[model samples]
Target chain A: MMRHWPIFFLTGLLSACGGGGGGGGGSSAPTQICTELNTPQSFTSVPLSAAPSSQPNSAPVTVEAYPTYGNGNFNIPYVTLQVCNGTHCVTVDHVIVDTGSYGLRVRADFPGISTLGLPSINNGSTAPIAECSQFLSGYAWGGVYSATVKIAGEATASPIPIQLTNDPNFPNPPASCTSSGSNIGGLNGLGGNGLLGIGVLIHDTGPYYACSTNGQNGPLNTPLNAILTNPIVSFASDNNGSILVMPSLANYPQGELTASGTLYFGINTQSNNTLNSTYSILPTPATGGNATFFSATLNGQAGPYPASFLDSGSNELFIPPLQPPGTYPLNSNGDYVPQSLQTVSGTATSLSVATDTAPLSFSLLDVTAGVNAGNTAFYDMGTTNSATAGSLDLGMPYFYGHSIVNGINGAQIQFNSTTYTGPFYAIH
Target chain B: MPYRYRWTVVLVGAIVTGTTHATLGGLERDVSHEGQPIAFAAATVHPLPAVPQGVHQQTILNLRSITLTEYSANGTVFAILWSGPTMPDYRSLLGTYFPSYQQVIQTQPLSPGHYRAPVAIHQPNLVLHASGHMGAYQGSMYDPSAVPTGLSITSLGIEP
Candidate 1:
C-alpha cells in the first residue's frame, strides 16, 4: 500500500520576503522540567554545560542546543530527565526532541549516569545477546534491561528496554552491526553511548523472512520497530510531541540574520510558544526511499540543484554525493558528485564562498499564511562533505542567535526578542 | 450395460444440466498484449492427488476453482488470488511482466500543498499481481485504457 508520506515544500507558492529579525536565547533563567502527564520536577538550578570547545581548523563542526523532555516526552525547555542504571541516577538536559523515530539514546558522558540495559536474543530456548543498526549515524547494540526514567517529576520503575554497549556481555561483535561512519566527528559528535529515539512508532520496519544462500531455513533477523520506544509516550501522561521553530532569512547572499523561539511539550501551553499557521511543509520521504535531487531544471540547464531538509536530531548540515545503483562499497570516483553554490540568479550577481565565517540565510512562513513574516539566521559552514544523503540536512545551526518556536500543535511556538515580537502563530 | 439413449432420458438430462461440462485436460493459461505472450511460468499440483485402488486411468476433471498464493521464502504472504469459479485468470490477463499500464485521465499539477488523490483502479490483472508478491510489481499503474501513470498512495480502501 502506498503510505501517505507527508509532502512539504515551497513551489511557485509566493513571492513575499524580508525577515523580522529579533528575539534570542541566553537568560540566567533556572532550568525547569515538565512532562505531559506528570507534575513538573524542580531541581537545583544549573546552567547548561558549555558546548565543546575544540574547533576543526578546516572542517566545519556544528554543536546544537537541544532539550530532554521530562524523561521521554517532547522537548520542553529546562526539563530534567532522571536517567538511571540499576544503581545510580543522573539528570540530563533534553533538547531536540523528535517524533519521527523511536529508541532511547543518551550521551555517555552525561552526569549522574551509570548502567545501561541490553536486549535479549532468543535462540530456541537459549537467550543470546544482540545489537541494532540505526542507519543514520551509528548502531545502538546492547543487551536489554530495565531502567527508571523520571520526567516531570514522575518515576517509572525499571524493566524499561535500553541498550548496553562497552560491556563484557558480548565477547565478539559483528562487523556488520558496527558503523562505517564511526571515525567522523562533529558538533553533536558521536561519542554518546547511544541516542534516545522517542518517536511515536517503534520497530525499524515490519518482520521479514530470510532466504540466504547458505540454505539456512531459519529467519534472517532485522531490528523490529516494536523493540525501541519513545519514553514520553510510555510515560505516565504520554507526552509524545515536539515543536521546531526557525527564523526566515532575507534571501540568499544577504549576510548574517537570526531568529529565536521555544519548543514546548504540550498543546495547552500555548501562550509563550505557538504555531501561527500551517507553513509550506515538505514531503519527508520515508527512509530508504532515496529520492535523488535531479537538477530539476527550471528553464534550460540552470545548473546545481540544492535540496535542504529541517532535521532536529541532526545538529549540523550534512551534504553527501549522489551515486549509481547496485554498487554497495562506493568507489572513490563513482558517479556520486557534490556541487557548490555559484549564484542565486536574478537577485545576486554571483554567489561565492570563503572558508572563513560566511553564512547562508533561509525564509520561514507558515504554509497556511504563506511567506509574509519570519526570521533569519547566521549559519556557520560545518562540513564540506558527508557519506550519507546527497543533500544538505539543516539542523539547529539555523536556530542560533534567535528563539526557535517549533509549534507542536499550532500555538505552541513562543519567542520574545528585542527587534521582533508577536504571536507569530496564526499569521494567516 | 450400455443402454441406448432414450428420448425420455435425453429430455430429462437436457432440462437438469443446462450448462456444458467440459473436462479441462492439462489446464494452462497465459496473459498477452493484443495476442503476443510476454512471460510464462507453470504451476502444478503438489503431492499429487490420491489415485483410487484398481483405477485403470486418471479421470479428467474440469478445474472448478484455482487458489493461487505467492509467498516469500519465509511464507510471508505477498499475494493471494481467488477466482470466483469463473473469473479471468490473472496469469493470462497481466502477461509475464505487467505491461498493460494505466494513464492519468486528468492532470492536476500540485504546487506545494497537501492533496488527496482518489484511488484509480487499474485493470484487475494488475490488481491480482499487486496482491501477490508485490516485490516484482512496478509502481506505474494502468488506467482503464491501459495507459501508464504515476501512483502515490496514502491509505488502503476501507471495508464496506
Candidate 2:
C-alpha cells in the first residue's frame, strides 16, 4: 500500500473586481476526505457504468459526484489508475486528478506496474537521479519506471515513466513538492496523493524536457519512463479523447451562488450526452502548449469563449491574461518574476472557436482567490526555467460551483445554459 | 455576430540559392498535434528539447493557414500551433478541432545566409462553400511567399 501524490484568476465587474488567487486556508486537522461542490438538482448520480458509444441526441447528462477518498480533505472524488498485467487489476485508490499538467503519473509500488529501466539521469557530467519539477506544481522526483495504466475502461500499455515522492532520496521533499513547506495558500491540499491531468496541451509543462533545457533526461522529458500516460489514450472505443460539460451559472442573490455541473468520459459517443449545438466551441493548443482563445485584441477582443474543457485534474479555473493592474509577482525556480498580463479583447461578447481556426486572445481567471491573496505560498505558478514560460494557471476556482463533464471521446467541454445561470460567487 | 475574417501572411524575401536560410512563416495552428506552427527564423544555434537541432533529416513541416469562414455562431480562432521558434503544443482534457492544416515542408536547421523574416497578415481570402455553410464570419490564410528556388510545393489546403 502506497500513498499517491499530486497537485486561477479573474476579473472585475468593471472595477468592483475582487482579489483573485488560488490558495486554501491554514491547514486544518487532516480531514477525512475531499470536499465536493454542492450537487445540482438537475444531476442524478448515475451508477459509474461503461461509457457507451452513441447517445440519443438529448439535453446534457447530469453526472453525480463520485465517492471522495483521503477522507474528504480536498481529496474527495479521486481518480484511480488501475495497473493491469493482463490477468489481474490493481486499482490505486490514492490517485489525484489534475488539469494543470498533462499525462498520467502512476507509482511503482502498484501491483502490476514496472519502471522503465532508463539510464541514470546525470546532468551531462554526474549520473544523478533525474527528477522533474513541472509548471506550477512540485518536483516529481524518482527513479524511472513504466507500466500499463487503466482508467475506467481505457488504458495505455507499458508507458515510459518515473515514480518518486515515495522515493527515499526525495525524503524531506521541498515544500515545492510537499504540502508542509513550498505549497502556499493551502493549494497543497489540491496536491492530492497522485494527479491525473486533463489540460488542453499535448506535452505537460510546455515540452521543456531535461534533454531540451539541461541535456539531462528528466521526468517532463521522459514522463513515459515515470508512468505518465494520457488516460484518454487508454480508453476502449472512443479513446481519442473526452470532454467536460458545465452549466452556465448566473450570480445569485448573495452574489455568485454555488452551482454544480457534470463530467463525462467520451465525446458524442456517450449515451447520456449530446454535443450541444447551442454553446460556443473554442480550440485549445495541441498538447502542453498554452490554451489560447480565438482573438488577438485585448480587453475582450480574443474570444470564442464560454469555451468548455473537461478537466477534472485541475483545482481552479484557468482563464487568459487580464489587463493592467492585473499583473502579479510570482516565484520561479526561487527567484520572483513578474507575470505578464494580457487582456481578453474582441468585438463580440460571446464567442466560440471551432476545430480549425486562427489564433486569438486567451485570458485566465486567477484561481487562488478565496485561499487568500496576501499569502505568498498560495500559488506555485510553474517553473521559471520552463520552455513555455507563463504565470497563468487554471485551478479549482475554474471548477467551483460549475457543472463539469470529463472522460469523453471527442475532446470538448460544454456548458448547459439551463442548469447554471450565474452571477459568479467567491470560492472561499 | 459580426463576421470578421482573419489570415496569416509571412513577410516575403528574396529566396537565395546555394545559401540555406531558415525561413519562418507566421504562427499557424498545427491541428495534428494540438500545437502551433512556431517558426524559428534562427535555430541550429542552440539545442532545445522536443526541438532537436542539427538538421538530422530534412524534416517535413506542414505549412498551414487558418480561415475563419463563419462567425455567425460566435466562433473565433483560438491558437496558432507552430514549433521551433514559438510555443510548444499541448494536450487537452478533451480533444478539439484545428483551424490550421498540416503542410509537409522539408525543413532543416539553418546553415549560412540561413535567415528568414517573419510573416504577418491581417486578413486574406477564405472562401466558404455553397451549401448551407453560413458566410457570416471573416476568413484568412498563411502561405510562405519567399520559398527558395527549386523547392516544390507538395500540398496546399485551407483549414477551418
Candidate 3:
C-alpha cells in the first residue's frame, strides 16, 4: 500500500497543475480539461435503455458526468421536475433524485420558480415557516412553501409542502440553523438545481422546530402538514414506493462518460414496477433515529453494522475498512488508494427477520486516473468510512445493473398475493 | 413553571457567566451550563457503567430529541457524542475546536465526484468522525490525551 502512495500523489499534482490555467479567462465555452490524460481503449459492453420509458409513472434519470455549470459529478442521478401554481408551471432540470432524504427542495433563486407565486406556509403566526435540513457534509436552509409537484406524467392532485431553499425573503437564518454546518443551498453547493427526496418516509422527520425572524425565540415545531413533505405521497396513484433501474457497468473499469436509467414510481402497483419474487426484502426501522437504515456486515469485519442503507444521493460506496487505518494508502482527500482492482463483499440483514439477508458486494479501484481523464461513472469506486465504522452507505454505484426498490413507510404493497407493509428495501 | 420564567433564568446565568455555552475539553460543570440554554428537556446525568471509576456521562436532549452525550472524568470532559434526526450545533459542542474542524472541512477535496461523504478529522490530539443523511445523523469527537486511562474511546459505543 505504501508503494502506491507516490503514484497517487503525483497524479493529484499533475491534475492540479492542469486545472490551474483556466482561472483568469473571461466568459468562454467550457474547456475540456482531461483531454491530455490517458484514456482507456477497451470499455464495458452492457445493454442499456437509450432513454427513459414513456410509462405514466416512469421518469428519465440522467447522469451528468461532467456538467458545464460546476465541477464534474459522478453517479449523481438527476430528473427534471415541474412545479405548478394552478395553471402556471415551471420546469426545472438537474433536480437530484435522492433516496437518502425526504421531500422536494428547490432553489428559490431559479428563474421561473421564483415567479410561480407559490403560497408560503405560516406557523399560525404571521411569520412564514423556515427549515434547516442537515446532511452528513452540509445542511440546506430555506422557507417551506406549498406547490404542486409533477414528474413524468404523475402530478399531485393538490398543493403539497416543499422547501424553497435560499429564499431571499428569509435572508437571516437563526444562529441555531446556520450552526448546524456549512450551507449547501445554492446550485453549485447542491451540485444540481434542487433535491427530490423520495426515501422510505412519507414526511421529512426531524426537528420541525425553527427560529423565526421576529426575534430570538425558543424553537417551535412546525405543523406536520406545513412541513416539507415527500411529493411521492401526494400523487393520487402509485403512492406506495419507487424503483431505480440502471444498466450494469461491471465491465467498465474506467467508467462511462454518461449513463441513463429510469425511475419508476410505485412499487408492485403496475406491471412495469412489480417486485420480483427472487429479490430480498430487508425491513428497516420505521421510527427513531435509525428509521431509514438497516443492518449489514461488510468484508467479514465485526458483526452487524446498524447504520447500513442504500442511498442514491451519495456518489460512492462508504463502507468500513477491511483493515484498520494506515493499512491502505489514503489520498489527501481521504479516499482509499488500492494498488490494483479489488472486490469486497457484505451481507445486508433485515432488521426484523434474522433469516432475511441479502448478499452485497462491489469493486474498488483507484479512481484518480479515470476521474482525471474526465470519465464520470465508475462502478468500482468507494472509500473507507472511518468516521462511523458501523455504517455501510451503498451509494449510486450499487444501483447499477439492479432494480433497487424503496417501499415507503406505512404504505401497503401487494406482491404475489402477499401484503408487505413497507418502510423496506428490495434489491433484484 | 412558565416558559418565560425558565428562559429568564437561563439568560441571567449566561450574562453573569460571560459565556454562552460549554464545549469539548471544558470542565464537568460546563456541561450543565451548555445544556441549560437550548435543551428541550432537562439534562440527565448518570454514571457510565463498565468503565473506569470516577467517569460519568451527561446526556442532553434537545428540541428534536437529538441526544448529545458528554463523557467526563477528573472533572474534565474527554469526549462527546451526538446522534438524532438532525445535526447538533457544533459551535456549541466542539467549542474552540470548531474553527479547526471547519478549516479541515472547507479544505477537504471533493474532486473526482461530488459525493455527500462524512466528515472525519484525525489530528494527533483530536479525532472526530460524523456520518449520516437527513432525518438521521450520528458522530463522536474525543481528545486522545484527555481520555482517561484504562478506557478506549472506540469501546464506548459512541455512534448509533
Candidate 4:
C-alpha cells in the first residue's frame, strides 16, 4: 500500500498540471495537500525508564504523536516489553498498550524476536499451529509460540503462549485467514512494534481459536494453556486486571507531541491501583451476546445502545452520527469535519445495572486542521460508528483524563465496600 | 422423520460450496450452496421469523463462533448480517462484489492521526458497515436496488 503513494502523487501532479495549463488567463488557487508532517529522521524515541521498578505492578506508558518506529501514530499508548526464553532475551520498544483485545503479539520481523528462537507450540503435531488474530479492518496471521513476557518488573510466572505474527515458518497463510482483511502483521501497517492486549477477557477464543495446521484450515486441538494466553493473567499477583492512565490532552487543541502516563497491572490489589468510591463500576456479562459491552446513549439520539464498550485499540471515538450522514463534511480519511468545534455527549450505563452510568462527552474537530497543524494527539477527533446501531465504541480519547479499569473474567474485585466479579469496567 | 432426515442430508451437501459462491445480489439458492468446512464442523441452521411481507430470513450458526444471517426476497438474497469473534469469509460472502469492496477499502486515504476507524461503504447500489476488536465483531451489508419496495434494511433488526 505504501508503494502506491508515489504513483498517486504523480497522477495528482499530472492532473493538476493539465488543469492549469489547459485554461488560458484563468487562475485557480493552489490545492493544499495534507501529507504526513513528521519525517523518519524527525522521529524520536520516548526515553525508557532507568530501571524496572521494584513495585512489580506498574509500568510507564508513553504516547507520541510521532514515534521513532512504525508509522506516526496518535493517542496510542505504548510500553516497552521484554520477551525471554531461558537465557535468550530480547527487549522490544513501542509495543501498543491495548485494552481492547487479549494476549500479546509481536512482529516476527521485529529486531531480535526471530533470533530469540521462542519455542513453537505444535500441539503434538509436526505441523506448527498457526492463528489468525482478526481485527476490524486487518488481521495478524502467524504461529503460536511460548515465551516469558515481562512488562516493567512484572513477568509471567511461566512461558505463556503468544503469537509471533508473520512468522517466517508460516509464510503463506491459508486463504481463510488472508481473505478476512488486510495483513497488519508488519511495523508499517500495525503502526507499532507489536501489540500488548490486556483487555477484560482472560482468554482470546472464538474465531481466534480456529488454528490452522501447516497452512491448512483445521480445528485447534490445543489446550487452553497452550493457546495465545494473556500474560497479565499469568502473573503470580496483580493478575486480575489493568488500569490505563493517560494525561489530559485538553489544553492541546492542535494536539501534543508526547504524553506519558502509567499502566498499573492490578485493580484494588495494591494501594497505587485501588478503585476508590469516586469511580463508577459498570458490570458486563461474563457470557452471552456482546459479553464485555455495556449500554450507552448519545444525546439527541436514541435512548441506549446495548453493546457499547471502552476500547483503547480504536484511535477515535466511534458513535452514531449526530446528524444525518451528509450533515457534516468529511475529510479524505472519512473523519467528521465540522465547520466549527462540535461537542457530542452521552451516557454509558452498566449492562447489568442500569443505574450505574458514566457521563461521556467529546469534541469533534476539523481533521484536516489537525493534520495540517502537524500534531499527533488531538482531543477532538472522532468518526462515525457504522458497524452496530446498538453500539458505540468510546476509544482512546475517552481515557485521556480518566483512570479506566478493566477487570478480567472471573477475577474478584473489591471496590468501595462492594465485592464485584470480573468482566467489568470502572471509570474514575 | 424420514422427510426431516433427508432434508438434513440435502442441506449438508448443498452447504459444502456455500462459502465461495453465496453473495449479495445472487439468488437465494446461492446461500444454501455456501458453507465453510471449519465453520460447518459444528453447524446449526435456524429460520428467523419473517418481518415484512416478502422477505425470508435465516441464521446459520458456525461452531467456530460466527453467525451469518441471510435475507432474501423473491428468491434473491439482498442482504447479509454477521456477528462473531472474527470477520466472516467476505470473499465468499460478497462473491463478485468482494473485489470492489476490497478496492474501496485499500484505496481509502490514511490520515496519520486516525487509522483504526470502522469501515463504512455507501455506494449507489451497495452499502456495507463493519467494525469490531478481537473478541467481538459485527457488520451488515445489503443491496439497495434488490431490496423489496417500501422495506428498510434496518427494519430487519440486524444487530450483532
Candidate 5:
C-alpha cells in the first residue's frame, strides 16, 4: 500500500534529536494491537533462583546469566520459571532475559520439564488464539495459554497468558504469520528454549490468530487479560519495570564461553534498583511512537540516526550504514571488519572477536539523566543496511559494560519530582 | 495475507519487461526498473526522487518489512541492495539465480550477528550478503562487471 519508503535521508529529525527522555521500550499503552496493561496491581521484589541460598528472594530480583550451548554472541540469562495450572508446576531453564521485547513466551516442554498442560484462553467463542512473535530474521509461532508463572521466586499472578512455542497440540501455525517470516522460537532459531521479554510492551504483538478452523490472521479480538502477557503486572508489587545488572566480563570471550550476571524485577522498588540520579534517563517508547535521542553524528555529518536504545536479545550493536541507502561509503570493501580484541580483566587477559567490524564512534546519553550529558561507546557497526523503523540498536555488546533499567510500559519514572510515564531505559 | 498481491507489469494496459534478482545481475538496469518498481511501502525506506550517487541513479523500495534499492548507471542496472523482513522470496526474487544459490548459501559457514543467520554468497557471476533477526533484515546483491569502473559498492552505502 506504499510506494517509495519516503522516510529516509533525514537531517531534520536528527537536528531536533535530543534523545532518551528515558521514556523508551515497551508499549506506551496496552491497546487492541499492543497491550501494555498499566494494571493497578502493584508488584514487589521476589527473587526466584535455582541457587536461592546464594541470591536473595526479595527485592532487587536477580537471575543468573550464562552462555548458550552453541552460540556465544548473546548473553543467555536463565530464569527458573514455574508454570502452574493449579494442577502441576513445571520449571524450565535457559529463558533468555531480553529487553528488546515484552511478554513471556516459552516452549511447552524443556529437557527436564515436560509439557505445560495449561488451559487455553479462547476468544469467548472458544476458538483458541495463536501468537506470531515476529523477529527481523524470523518469527516465533505458538498458541496462547494461561498458567500461574513464577519468575525469580515470586508469583505475579496465577493463570497469566503466555504463548507456548513447544506445545505439540497447537503446533499448526496459520499461514498469515509465516508469509513474511519463518518461525525461530524453537531451539535452532533462538538458541534457547524460550524468551522472557521484559521490555516495555506488555504483549509482543505481531500477527495474532483466532485458531478454530485452521486459523485466520490479524488481531485476535480477545480481551486484554486473555492474550499474551508480560507477567510483571500480575505481581503483587514492584510491577513498574525491571533491571539487568550484568557485571563487566573479566575479558570478553572470543569463542564458545560463559559469563555471569543478574536480572532484577523493579526499577525503584528497592535499594538495589532505585533509579540513580547520575545515570541518564532515555525514553524508548513503543514502536511507531514518538520519543527522543541523545544526539548522533556519522562521518562528521551531524544527525544521521537520532537515538540509540538497548536490547539484550540482540548480540551486536547495529549502526546505520555510513553512506545513505543508495550510496556506499567506507574504506572497507564490505561492511564487516573481522577484528578481535584482548583486554586485561583484573590480572588476566580475555579476547573476544564477537563483532566482525571496524571501530565506530556513536554518542549516547547514559543510565540516567538528560541528553547533552551522555556517553558514547566505540563500535564499528560496519555498514548495516536495513530499514528498521527505530533508533540504532545497542544490543548485548552495548550492555556488557553497563547496568540498564528498563522502565515498564506506562509506569511512572521520576527524577526527583519530574515524573514521566515510562518506556524508558536507564543505563549506567 | 500481507503482501501476497502479485501485479505483473501492466504498462499502459500492456506488459512491460523487467528483471528479477537472479537474471538482473547481468541484465540492463532498466530490466530491474521494470521488474521491481515498488517493493513494500514504509516510512524509513528512502524515496530516490531521482537522487544521484557516484555513477548511478537510485531509488529505494521499502516493502514494509523489506528495503530494496535499485541502482542504474551507463544505461544498465549496476547493483541492488535488499534488506527485508525475510529472505526475498528466493523463488521469484532469485529467478535464474536460484539454481546456483544453494551451493553458495549452504556450503558457507553460518554468518554470525545479532540475527542468527548471516548469508554471504559470492558466486562467480553474482555476490550477495544478507542478515536479519527480530524485525530488521538486510542484504545486498551486485554483479562486479555491471558496476561502473571507478565506483565501488561501499560508495553506494553497501558493505564491500
Candidate 6:
C-alpha cells in the first residue's frame, strides 16, 4: 500500500517559513494511530435518497460517495471521467470537483485506472517524478503521469496531464513528507477516486519533484507536465472557466442525502452558462497571491484565514469561528442565520431578510448537528480553525442553490475580453 | 489566562525581526532555551529511525521538506516541532490539548487583510503558533508545565 502519496504537494511549505525541525533532548513518542481520523469506511454510491430533479446541464455531478469509500463528514461532490490513451480508456468515478485546490490527482493503483497503460511523465528526467502536495494538516505524495482526461464524455484539450497518486514507480514515501501528513492520496485515505480541481489556478504551485531510484530527488520545474493542472484551462472549445450549478435547499434544515446537481463547464460558452446580470460580484481575492488564492471577509471583518476558497470538496461553511459567539443572532430553531430581519428602532424584531439591514446577515449552527438533520446547509456558519495554518474553506454547503463561477487565471470571458483575467470567482 | 491570547505574540511577533516563533524550515540553534545560542557544528542529513530520546542533546531528523528536533524532560515529551513542506497534523499531535482549543477557539478580530495573515492560539496548558505556505510551513506547541526546570521554550525552538 503506497499510503503516504500526497506529500509531494507541499515540498517547501515548512522550509518556506523561517524554522526547520523540532528541538532536541526529548523522547519522541510514536505518532498514535488516530482511528477516528483514519477510519477507512466503505461508502457506496447510494442513489440520491431525496433526489431532486436533475438540473438542466451537460454532465452528471454527484455528492454521493462511492460505496466503501465515503469521506465521513465532508459532503464533497464527485464526477466520473474516462481517462485514456486513445481508445483504450478506463472510466474512473468519484473524482472530487474541487475549486479550493488546483490540478488533477488520481490514485495510481485505483481499481480501474491502474489497468490503463498510461505513460510516465519524466519531467525531463529518465528517473520518475514525485510530488508533495501539502494539505492544511497533511500532504499528498504521488508521482506524475500523462493521459487524456475526459469529463462528461468530452475530451479535455491536448493530452491532459495529471498527478498519479502513490506512484508505483516510487512506492516508498520519503520520511520528509510523511512526518507531517497521512498515508492517503486519492483512493487510499482520501475518499474519492481522484480530484478534478477546476479552480482558477492554471498550475499547482504546491511542490512536486523528480526522484532517483535509491530515493534521491530534488525540486522540479517542468511546468507543462510535472504539475497538477486545472483542465478547464486546457479545454479547446469552452476554454474560459466553469461553474457549479446546485439548487438551493435554502430552507431545508438537514440537507438531503443525495441532492442531484450539474457541474457546467465554461462560464459563458453556452446559453445556460451566461452570467446572471442582476447578481453582484463578490470578487475573487488577490489576497494571498498564491497563498489563500480566494480569501473572504467575515461580515465586514477582513482575513487572517489564508487558504479561503470556494470548495466543493469540503462539507460545510468552514471559516474561522467568531469570538464570544454571541454577536450573531440566533433563529427560533437556535440555528445561526445567514440573513435575519431585525427592527432597529421599533419595539419588535423583524424575522425576514427584506428588512432594511438583514440582507446578508449570517449566523452559526450547532456543530454536533449531523448534516442529515433538518439543519444541513449553513451560510453564516464558521467552524474551528487549524492552529497550524488558518483557512476559511467554503465547503459543499456553500453551493446550495448558487451558481459559482471561476474565471480562469489568464483567460478572459466578458464580451470585452479584457476586463477580467482568468482566476476570479463570481457567484450568481 | 493571558496566554490564551498568546495569539497576540503571533500577530505582533511576526512583525518583530529575528524573534523565533515557529518557523521550522530555517530552524537554527537553541538561542532561547540553550544555556547559550550556538549553531550546529555538523547537521545530520539522514532521517532518524524514529524521534531520538534525550533532553539536552538535540536530535535532528531530516525529512523531505522539513526536519524535526524534539525537546524532552527526563523522557517526557515537552515540545514537538515541524519545519518543511507543510505543517503537521495538530489534531493528532496535540492529543488532549486539542479539545479545549477546538471547543472554544477564540481570537480577537484584527483589522482587514490580516485575516489570512496567521494566528497564534495562546492558552495556559498548551500554546500553538503557526503560519506560512508551501516553502514556509512552520509551527510548534509545548506544555509550559512539562518543561524541565532549567530549560526555556525558546531553547526548544519556539519563540516565547
True contacts kept of each: 0.00, 0.00, 0.42, 0.39, 0.08, 0.05
Once superposed on the true structure, which residue ranges of model 3 sit more than 4 Å away at CA? A1-55, A69-72, A206-219, A324-329, B1-22, B30-49, B109-115, B158-160
Indicate the TM-score of model 6.
0.61
Tell me the TM-score of model 5: 0.59
> Candidate 1: misplaced stretches above 4 Å?
A1-80, A85-88, A93-101, A107-129, A135-140, A151-159, A179-194, A198-226, A245-263, A267-274, A278-308, A319-378, A382-390, A401-428, B1-160
Give all TM-scores, in the order shown. Answer: 0.38, 0.39, 0.82, 0.81, 0.59, 0.61
Which 10-residue span in candidate 6 chain A carries the lowest summed lDDT?
A33-42
lDDT of 6: 0.48
lDDT of 6 by residue, A1-428 (tens): 01121232223222221112121111132221100011111112111111121223357777653544222424557788877886688888878777766678887767767677777766444645556566544456666677887776356667766777765555444444443424556453556778777775555654444554433233333344555667766655565667788776655443455566788876666786767564333334222223223323344444444334556665555444444345544444233443432111101111111121112222354433434343323433444444223344456766767777766656555532324445466665
Ranking by lDDT: 3, 4, 6, 5, 2, 1
Question: What lDDT does the true structure give each of the candidates?
Answer: 0.25, 0.27, 0.67, 0.65, 0.47, 0.48
lDDT of 1 by residue, A286-337 (tens): 2111111111111122313232333344333332332222211123422111
TM-score of chain A of 3: 0.83
State in Å the error of residue A106, model 5: 1.5
Q: Give the better candidate number (1 or 6) by lDDT.
A: 6
lDDT of 2 by residue, A243-282 (tens): 4444432222111212233335544456544446433334
Docking class of 3: acceptable
Superposed by TM-score, candidate 2 places the C-alpha of residue A51 at a distance from the truth, in angstroms, of: 12
Error of 6 at B124 (Å): 7.7
Give interface RMSD (Å), model 2.
22.2
DockQ of candidate 6 (2 decimals): 0.07
Better of 4 and 5 by lDDT: 4
User: Root-mean-square deviation of each candidate, in angstroms?
Assistant: 22.9, 19.7, 13.3, 12.9, 13.6, 14.0
Who is ahead in TM-score, 2 or 5?
5
Model 3: per-residue Cα lDDT over B6-42, one tens digit each: 3554445444554435578886655645543333232
| Least accurate 10 contiguous residues by lDDT in model 3 chain B | B40-49
